[model samples]
Target: MNSTSSSDSNGPKSFSVNFNQDASSLQVGCRNGYRLYELSSVDSLELVYSNGAEDSNLVERLFCSSLVAVVSLTSPRKLKVCHFKKGTEICNYSYSNTILSVKLNRSRLIVCLEESLYIHDIRNMGVLHTIRDTPPNPSGLCALSINHENCYVAYPGSSSIGEVQVFDAVNLHAKTMIHAHDSTLAALSFSSSGTRIATASEKGTVIRVFSVVDASKLYEFRRGMKRCVAISCLAFSLCGQFLSCSSNTETVHIFKLEDPHNSPRRSVEESSWMGYLTNYLPTQVTDVFTQGRAFATAYLPFCGVKNAIAIATIQHQLRLLVATESGVLYIYNIDPNEPGDAVLYKEHRLDAVPENFDKTDKGRSSSPQNIEGILGSYAGIVKGNPPGQMSGTESDKLREMAAAAESPPKGAFQFSDDQEYPPLTQISD
Candidate 1:
């Protein structure tokens, strides 16, 4: 959970917004306290719980369950796990430094500080493992998989570069390292199935997706190259077929991960001219053609504010949800057949509690209290790339090929279609 000051002068003082593991619920922490909303409906949010006893800067709901992890502004160094439905604090832990972020799954709950992380068993709220002296993560940049079986956690492996270290939280060991980018990583997220992870560097230009099983580069999408902006969030749809990225800019980019074979075909004339000039052009220019572009984009009513995004299916319609720190949630309708701008459908002010809210109605989330039912399984494993398969550096190869031959190298144009990686699967519309 990260806090950002409200950019709108008329908005609340300061707040933070975070979606639960599945985006089925949203938690907004503010100076007053926090509010939890169930997003099962597209037109309105069902106010599940609200409390103003203490100011909270971080609030993470455990996948629509009764549990929630909270960090208060008055006590930044402490973490409180409470059963929001019961209004009872289950447990609280204090740290040596201010808590930067807290992530939770059904099996594990991780508390991240500036230089260390504590992994706790969610069943009992007891410390199971400690990762000390990790690279400095001032923003507490880390993600935990919702899948209880695989239970992979990813954090920045290096302070200078965008290297991601995936750890098997269940087995408690290092899984693999992925050199995602040259710049420091700004945001990363796991697909619902945990088979793929998306990463965005501080540069905020190109977004890359890697196979969790082998740490191989799967798809690279170009956001823009004009000016750099801070990326606020990276989210994979629940179906794992679409990835949504929100930045400081007004636009939210949605990239399709569906297999190209099943996607609606486009005429070759619609392709960019750069696609045919890859061998003759510089890597920087060819990179634009080689990478995938956004399948759909949605414009925000406001800009320059930190926001989090999620893609979900609501009443059989694909909707993109954007929650900004300024205390507003925007819902956009995405057309599967269109490859352009998404239409804004609805907007709700998170701070506005519904008139007929019922705080005692725990029946909405009245599933079994079992950990397996709350978390659900959706994760996988990954190994290092095989020999001779370049994990990075497309520019170096292009430069060498330019100096070496008059003709294009053997496979200079087939970057995305390389047989080394498995083809991406398409999700049914």
Candidate 2:
């Protein structure tokens, strides 16, 4: 494993960092406002612009371009859109309730409130559509595809259970709704082409991928059993071949997408025998047979840090950049063909050295100390077995897996069902 630390004294305590779609730049939000950094150089982060302020809950550089947006969580919650090159505000919007999340592409800007979503045209900030009475979302569980031509947005449906509402990027019209799980939703992500979307519920045991065109379940990958971990982020590779998910745990689970047309079929003997037994076998048996099949997993190389909140894939490589609450970044190179976990490629702190260091350090010690050793053991990535597959007592694993695979009621989305439909309350003007 590789590691590095920052000498900068003003590093953020807690930060929200996002890589532009192509991983060319990074937008960081912290207690001291938002800063845009160029990621062309691997050795150092070059500051491109700085919008200094007191606090910001979220900051994103849209589609890896010059446009940047910020969401402040403080009183009089506001959304500020600015031009990164000019450092000028293009549009500023305020809301009565806290702005839970903000997402944007070249054509659209999506601002998510607690129970509503507003879609606007990026050029003029004109409201295109408003979705109301969304699920009780506290973490702002929403995802927007990076593709411009076939862009899609996904958020929790207006229900208490795991329902996802997908909308088209061009007109913000509801395309389809997916009943993903039986619990509250945790995270949602769209494939690179926007043809498929992935959903993870608050239970966090299973991840299901669905086709956006028909809203049909495509694949189900087991994440874990026994524990209900919160998934913080989900990312799809640029080519739409692989998916990576990170949670409140140290390890990140990667699943290989099964291509319906090109996937090889099992041999006649293998399928006939297995299929016969699978029908009689319990659901737990089927789950165990499929556990960790055609997939590889990875873990954080170090210990004593929080789980990763942000994850992004580097184009044309098996590399991933993971960011934690402690302001540390981890780079891992995962081999898709291999069954083992990912290996640490490099690690560094996001902060840089203070500019006036030389002047202030003249009378102090010159030797730098190891930050991890000095800080002792704080809450960090706990190293254990990588997530996915069954663990612990056999009985416990069977019980949890059985619960996770239970299906939601059929035709529950119909009006005749008892699913709660809260009135559509528009909070944005």
Candidate 3:
């Protein structure tokens, strides 16, 4: 799999023959400007997908190890959210031109574009409402996150007591703004049951988890080392027994919120993708990221969907884009339900792609494309990531406790041509 780069920096790039793991009987659309490679090695590896099909000069590839959803975003602005089962397009939602601030439930997505917040339903790629709580600023929409009922999310001009501004996911309306952090807040998360909320800011490094019902500080955790290090990302475990946070330190901290009286049990872990950039991203281009430094920080920071958190960084360095709007993708296993080592299992990237992919009338319309196939199956779905063996942390003691039993990490989703992960049927366009 050894390889080297050529002078044609932003052009056709290759991967180490060792890492190529596309399906064996791979085929390409003759009219499509893409090709698939088969790696004799890496048997159980997920089928690596490349996206330079439209044009070789600009290319992108993507792969998912767990719950895979088909979504689309335009570089210039507008975002198209789509939900797919096997290979069919279920429905797509188009939102106004703005940076997609947050995507909550599979069907609940918040796109804070331009001067407003848009509630879109991937159920059929449609926009429910365009709520303009605050006027748009040149800085662009900062950030947003939705709650369980798809009700509220944190918004701008928020206050110390105002942890998050609740929103009506069904109708774009001003729900309520809860008094939260002491300083300019950076990120927010609602406890699983929607009974509590957590806030962090430039001034507050420790995440102050408070009860939404009483607006009382339930517990506080000291986060990062630097100043104004707000909690960049946060999420609660499935059973609502633990809380996890990631920061500018590029570290993922998992906390066992098992002990109600005591603080939540927390552990710190780093991303494993740090090496891939050197392993894959740097080959095509040399700028933006140094030998090891990725162009962008990992993102979504919290993905409970796969019972794991996802990290979006830059990659396939050959064709690089400096826009903060562009980033890579990676996933890891941090099951709050499980008691054991925080395993950072899967890592992937959305290959270096061109801006107008689905933009022009010609290509796939900024709307992502899918192969027609099944929705799901029992064979490929990996199961059992948590047991009851582990518990507790130093400062934040976990209150939740269970019996000692363990389950294996879910196997990678297997994608094949005939019946890719059978049972996963397309929702419907």
Pick the TM-score winner: 1
Clashing pairs in 1: 213-382
User: Which digits, one per residue and each the tens of the lDDT, describe model 2 over residues 164-262?
Assistant: 889886855788989988987888888878899988887888888899999998887778773657777777777677778877665678877865444
Off by over 4 Å in 2: 1-13, 41-44, 260-276, 291-294, 301-316, 353-429
1 or 2, greater by TM-score: 1
Model 1 lDDT on a 0 to 1 scale: 0.74
* TM-score for predicted model 1 compared with the true structure: 0.80
Give the alpha carbon lDDT tens digit for every residue of 1-429 in model 1.
122332543364466999888888889998889998889898878887888779999998877666778999898887876656546554466777899999987678888888888887664454668888999999999988877766888999999999999988888988999999999999989987777899999999999999888999988988988456889799998888899998988789999986644544323412656445676888887777667779999977766788889998888999999988888888999987688999998988876667676655642343323322111110000111111222134224323333322232333222123111111111111
All candidates: CA RMSD in angstroms? 16.9, 18.9, 19.1
Q: How well does candidate 3 match the true structure, expressed as C-alpha RMSD?
A: 19.1
Candidate 3 stretches greater than 4 Å from native: 1-74, 83-96, 102-107, 121-126, 133-150, 157-163, 171-173, 228-230, 260-429
Model 3 TM-score is 0.47
Clashes of 2: 3
Tell me model 3's lDDT, rounded to 2 decimals. 0.36
